[model samples]
Target: MLINVCNLNNNHELSTTEMNGQFVQSQLQIASLLKMETTSTDQKEFICKCRELYKDNKTQLHFVDEFER
Candidate 1:
């Protein structure tokens, strides 16, 4: 058995915000970060936000697949 994982953020240009708010290694996928949705209000919890200009569709999905646990 084998598994593959990729850090999509490794390729793009990192901005000051993404650099500071980076929640994972190096940074996050420009698209994945842009599409993140949260309702938290605290500034300290301001994570998963992109450049606010990232419009890529790579991480966009229609439905979340649920698995039986």
Candidate 2:
């Protein structure tokens, strides 16, 4: 259950169960937001906001996993 949020353009890893749960919830929220009948520009703005939130809360970023190809 090691989810790599960075792979999804995030800067953190969902290492713990709690963090993973939050990640899932965040993803669901993003999906719901995207589903709204908004303009493309608004969708992009929402995505940027989500990314900023993740980036600000990220603790372990820019670390390369040697085993990952």
Candidate 3:
């Protein structure tokens, strides 16, 4: 897993496994912070945020596979 933490906070440095753990921890933290075990509104907001972030980051990744060959 070629995880990228380039957008993470300045004080953090995460390896692949650490990055995976961080992702799980992030979902847990978000759920806890919102004080919900499961809620549609919370889920929707989280999904939207993730989608936007993914799109932004994906655009930044100019992989060789995407080049005009």
lDDT of the candidates, in the order given: 0.39, 0.54, 0.56
> How many angstroms is residue 49 displaced in model 2 relative to the true structure, after the best TM-score fit?
13
Give lDDT tens digits, candidate 3, residues 1-69.
123423467335667787777778777766666684767776666555555556657653343224312
Tens-place lDDT per residue, model 1, 18-41, is 656654533455456557774545
lDDT of 2 at 46: 51
| Poorest 10 consecutive residues by lDDT, candidate 2 | 60-69
- After superposition on all CA atoms, what RMSD does each candidate show versus the true structure? 13.8, 12.6, 11.0
Per-residue accuracy of model 2 over 1-69 as CA lDDT, tens digit each: 123343454435446775677778879877876687867776566556555555755542222122121
Please tell me which predicted candidate would have the highest lDDT against the true structure.
Answer: 3
Q: By TM-score, rank the candidates, best first.
A: 2, 3, 1
TM-score of 1: 0.21
Q: What TM-score does candidate 2 reach?
A: 0.35
lDDT of model 2 at position 22? 71
Q: What C-alpha root-mean-square deviation, in Å, does candidate 3 show against the real structure?
A: 11.0
Cα TM-score of candidate 3: 0.31
